[model samples]
Target chain A: MPFRHLLLSLACFIVFSCKNETTPAPSKATSQRPDPHSLADPFNDKMLELQLKLKVDFDKKILSGSASWSFDRKEKTNEIIFDTDNLTNRKSDPWERRNPNHLYARTP
Target chain B: MTLGKEETPTTFTLEPRDSILGSALRIKLSPNTNYLTIHYSTLPEAAALGWMDASMTAGKKRPFLFTQGQAILSRTWFPCVDSPSSRFTYAAEIETPDGMMALMSAKNPQQVSPDGMYKFEMDKPVPPYLVALAVGDISFQPIGKRTGIYAEPSMLKKAAWEFADMEKMVETAEGLYGPYDWGRYDVLVLPTGFPFGGMENPILTFATPTVITGDRSLVSLVAHELAHSWSGNLVTNATWDDFWMNEGFTVYFERRIMEALYGAEYVEMLAQLEFWELEDEVRAFGEKNPDTHLKGNLKGRNPDDGVGDIAYQKGASFLLMLERLTDRNKWDEFLKNWFQANKFTSKTTEDFLAYLKTDYLEKHGLTANVDEWVYGPGIPANCPRPNSTKLAIAEKAATNIVNAIPATKEWTPHEWVHFVRNLPKKTTVETLKKLDSQFNLTNSGNAEIRCAWYDTAIRRGYVKEILPQVEEFLVGIGRRRFLMPVYTALKETGHVEDARRIFTKAKPGYHAVSYGSIEQLLK
Candidate 1:
């Protein structure tokens, strides 16, 4: 019974060793390569909805806004950007483009 | 809040319940009731705007907070998250007098009911510094497609006419850039002395009374604020550390818009003057300290400090240099690309440089030494030049003036004329001062010579001290017939008190337009 058990254990070890030997090592190029298409969001990788409120007093020459941004964290980035939405009150022009909010992640 | 010392340097914690980006926090601070629960992006106001007579202090008498007011006390009013880089959106519900009008960000225009209360909505996001509010009786004008609102009931008509070019400029800018994502544009004409130059608050801009040239030449400021629609309002800076991002980009954009409106010569001159102004700022700040970090300088200073000529001068020159290095087509493409890529987001100097270096500069065969110019002290040496096109044009003008001296007006001209016309290519301030002595209008000199002498003196910075004499020459010609630019510059430089005296002396000779314009500025 002892001899039979020893032979079974040896067979199992051989099978495991043979499987490990057949598996190829990861190549250097594969390890170093990062997907070029994965462009990180300037604000953050997390894509989330945001809400903002802007107020303008044309008479008093006062412009202000309130905003609540909802974003998720997928990966860390260098900075985040927010737009100044106060431009909604002004008339549009073809030459001067509209202003948009932005984000830049923190950089070490 | 109680404080405790730890020998092992207290470990920090972050509880960002109010943060927009999934509870991101940098530092650990104990929660305390004394700490105000601030929300949204807006200027900090200690007292609500209304007939709260008690909130009205002695400082209220000043015109638009030139001394101290709500805008100045933004620090005391709120926790002052003073970083322009930390961009986020804010949602606020302000409870004010039922009859008062409340405005913020880009919001749907509100309607006033019988209750006299108004509420506006701005769904677009914004930063804290760009937040603002003005409470007063105001009027509106529909001169063009866009609406112009004036805080003063009487100024609405004038405001409408003055801002007539808004639609045209915006349309032109949109063509050059992409379509403006933000819907409409508007201006709030508050009382005089707006503290800072003008805050380009997203859709609505808060303008200083000084900027209003009832004649509407103040369009440059409008163009500038409009340009900010893209530079500041759209692509915001990540932090105050990169103020040049907000200012430099805005200044460059403003000049581009102005160049589109005015001739290149005018824009070129403005650029030259702006460069000199930046030099002046650097010299002044250099005298005190070498640090040119705008954040350090703008601290406790007026709003204008945040946007001095350095932003214009250093910032524009940087772009001009970039244009020179990267050719016009490539530069334009780069700008368009950057704007498109980073629209409606906050950014930093590093991100800007990084993206440009990799995507634009590297791909387009340009230098990655942008940092040497942007982050370093002083202007870059041996900056790339855009050929001798501008210089050749200027030289041509000088040659034309020199060659066409009219045989009659050349040899027989006054000594002053000969001395000035024969001046070397470059004249130092001291050298110019010495030459000023040789000019005496009282002598028998023709109008051209006298005008030339006056121009030289003005260039040399003696126009103000010798205003009486400049006025004497100007009045003889009748100031009304003069070009508007020169007259405007002179009026701007001339002290209000001195102008009052000079105008009083020759009240009848003053052109109604010029006279009216000067009076408005003085007020």
Candidate 2:
């Protein structure tokens, strides 16, 4: 009975180590001062440079463009946030249909 | 969305919108991902963008577009951190309609692009709000080797003549602070509908056509904007709450530049007028209102709410007090060192106070009412009193208009403003009519004088005589500085119906910044 219990404990430890390796690490907390107006966490991940290629449409009064952001990721976060107002994404993604309010509910 | 040059697909989440702050765009990053690109478009009603039809422009031939992004409007045009705390270098390829030129707050092209494709590069890391762009039937003329003017072809000569002292202003400013880091300084004269007097977009300053008063009397607005190169563009406020740091410092620096170029007497008139404006604003907000404090609490509110005379005048008053405490040479040295130390960084109010404590106060072994001036409500007791001999003459002239008419012959715009603003509140409409008929105040080509005259006219019940001119002035100019007082007077004097009517006709032409304030006032 003792030998069997030891073998079972060893198997449990191996399974836990494998799970840890597969899962991504959590991001570390940042020390930068908070900006009440923005939702970006610039201390953790910040954009270093930006490249823009935009076409002006006077008829529509809109600017269609590709904004390429070169960033430095200080932490291990899987997501980087930016601020936008009155802009539309040209490309459709799976999350396009997701309710943003619902996603906000999931956020801390 | 794609990652880097490989164009690998990535996932992003668009958060729910807040009424004031808009929405947040969250993009997923892989373990090794360091770059991502977003493909998006700006909505027509973006608050920062002012898209004008040809009929609204000065030339009345080609359309014009400009952007005003200060105080959290940049996010409306492009996705970014959208906070002064974040700074980055940017490069762009802007394509415009054929025959039009594009300019930005970056290295610009002197001539129009034959193919309507223009490239810009801003190597220095600047706050996102300073990223500006303008496209229109614009032409450029050089004032000096490093200074120039951009305007509609029709207004080019007048604007260039008005701002001929641009090179001198830059040289004087550099003499005071440090080198003008941005390579070139240029001014673009937008259509009459441009809201503010001037926006200090680095490398290029967006000015209103209204400033081109033909006499160059209102060019202090240029000096003010140019001063921002050292105070605002170089050293920024970390958050909107610390906006006084940007504006107050610029106002002080502007006066210094003006004093260096013109003289003490000229700049003193400017300072005196601002002091009166500040006092009136304090009374309007009530002396104890927290918003009057230099270090504002703008959490959960529009930052623009804190941008009245308090930030511009009260903040400068605090600096003036410091200068009076220490000698001018010592203050100048301290300020020069302060700007050099924080050249490209955004600083909060606390950061500044700490720096001052260590660098200025401790070094000089002096103490000041810093807390009372910054965090306390209203203007402090120790505020400096600006005494302008010319303004005193203007005030005396306002007391007796008949005797003062001849004296006004040599009056500058500042003196005119002081005279009109100091007019007796109980003066009869007949007196106003006589004054207007003599001076042609209703038809004054100078916007500052016109705005001041209109405010007095509306208050003293003289609106009936100049009703047509008032409506024309209100509809023609979109500057909030000129619009607010006249509208408020109309409402306060029981003309809400008239105010609403004029605003309905004028709202579409006003930029979001101007209309937003007016809408709140009328509401």
Candidate 3:
């Protein structure tokens, strides 16, 4: 009976470990010595590459576009910060591995 | 926003906006996230961007657009880590109106794209501020294999001729430093509304049309911008407080390039003029002000406030002092190594001091008054004073002119500027009339000479004679360097109403960077 109980406990532990792997816990915010003129914590999550697709609108006198950024997460930080002024219509999209159209492809 | 390759929906929040620093955009990321895309638009009056109608261009046929992203203005256009320490490589697909040429601080195309879709890539990591763009009815003329000029078709030939020695300048700069790391050294002559003299934007420099004086006398501005390839672009200042690291080193390198091309006597005049400007700034700011220090404390102020003689001239003077103390060959070697070692990186004043202590100073077993020069307020006792025989002659002529001695007619633009700047303070309007009659100062084409003459004219109460030209200049030119003093002079000389009138007419033509200060001054 004891051997059967030990087997059942082992199975429960394995299932829990697999579930933990599939669903990562929410990351905690990291602290850094901020740049006085900027609120970005580049030390925690540093931008490595940027891809922009922008349209110049002469009549409206604005630049509307999407800025895709690739960065290296130095620690388990919850967020990445960027400086912006007088920018509007902002919509943020996080990467989704299952979306084929959202793969690392340049705008055509 | 999307994160990583999976295109998962992400959450973001635009934090409360600060009056000076602007807004901070924060986005949550998964543990595996490496990519995030933000879709946005810039407002019409974005501080870094200048949009001009056809009327503003030399051709007056097609509209023009340019961006000046130095200091902290880059954040006004794009969402990025706008700090100087944050460096990133970029690829951009910019769509413009058909028939317009688009260029960036990247690998540029000489011709306009047929579909109005232009692609640019900067393989090297650069601070976001250096990423620039311009779209207009522009054309390019190759000055050499790796040098060229870009301007409106109407102004192309004149610009090409004015910057004829651009190819030689690249070679001269390379011979001094390691290499012209940014492949091609080309200049884009923007419309009259360009606020600054020149913005060093990696491979492509955005220059003011004012620099095309037809005499090639102002090409030193080209050298100054090009020197930034090594000083400001390659190795950037980590913060605005350490801005001297960018301007001072570039100024020093610029003089060396000028010396290589125009000889030492010519550079001496240039250095002497800069020293005089520095002196005037020190007097205006009060000698004990901390802002006069090389490394300023700009924690709560706009970084633009730091863009003055303290960063450019005082910074250069400090480097010149170091060169004076050390052997030229050793100094050159140290500088080359410094550039090579710190290329594509941002550094602070402390970082440079530590490097100097370790590599150059300790290696030479030398001790210098670096502390007094950088930390202490005002110019130090050890500050090297550049003496110019040319300027001496101009000063004597200024004195002679007051004594009814006729001014020499065969002076270079530098000497003319020195003469105009050194005019007697107490000279009567009659003396001014005599000088203007001789020099035709009111009708001078050279922007530098015109600006200096106007400042003197405004101070000597000769505004009545030069008011029309002053209005024309204030209206036509948008360079802040020329605009600020002229406007200030008008205001200080009890001509605030006049300043307001001209500014009201000129404000629309000025870029936000230029108009913002004038708006405050007028207020």
Best by lDDT: 3
| Total backbone clashes of candidate 1, pairs 3 or more residues apart or in separate chains | 81
Better of 2 and 3 by lDDT: 3
Interface root-mean-square deviation of model 2 in angstroms is 13.7
| Cα lDDT tens digits for candidate 1, B1-523 | 1111210111111121111111122221122101111122222221212121211211233122111112222221222233343344544444333444444445524333345444544455554456555544444555446545544555566666777888877877776667776677777665432333456776777664444545454467778888887887788866444567787877777878888877676566556545654677778777334355432233222332354555566776787777777567778778878888887777867788888788777888777457566656665675432232443443343344434322222222323343444444444445555444433432222444555555555554556555666566444333332322234445565644655565565444332334544556556
* TM-score list, all predictions: 0.54, 0.90, 0.91
Residue B144 shift from truth in candidate 3, angstroms: 0.7
Q: What's the best-to-worst order under lDDT?
A: 3, 2, 1
Every model: Cα RMSD to truth: 19.6, 9.0, 8.9
Candidate 3 residue-wise lDDT, B260-372, digit = tens: 99999999999999999999999999999998999978776778889999999999999988887779888898999999999999999999999888888889987888888
Off by over 4 Å in 3: A1-34, A90-108, B1-5
How good is the docking of model 3, as DockQ? 0.24
Predicted candidate 1 versus true structure: per-residue lDDT over A1-108, tens digit per residue: 000111122233223323422442222112121211111132332323233333433234333332333444434322332221111111222211221111111111
True contacts kept of 3: 0.59
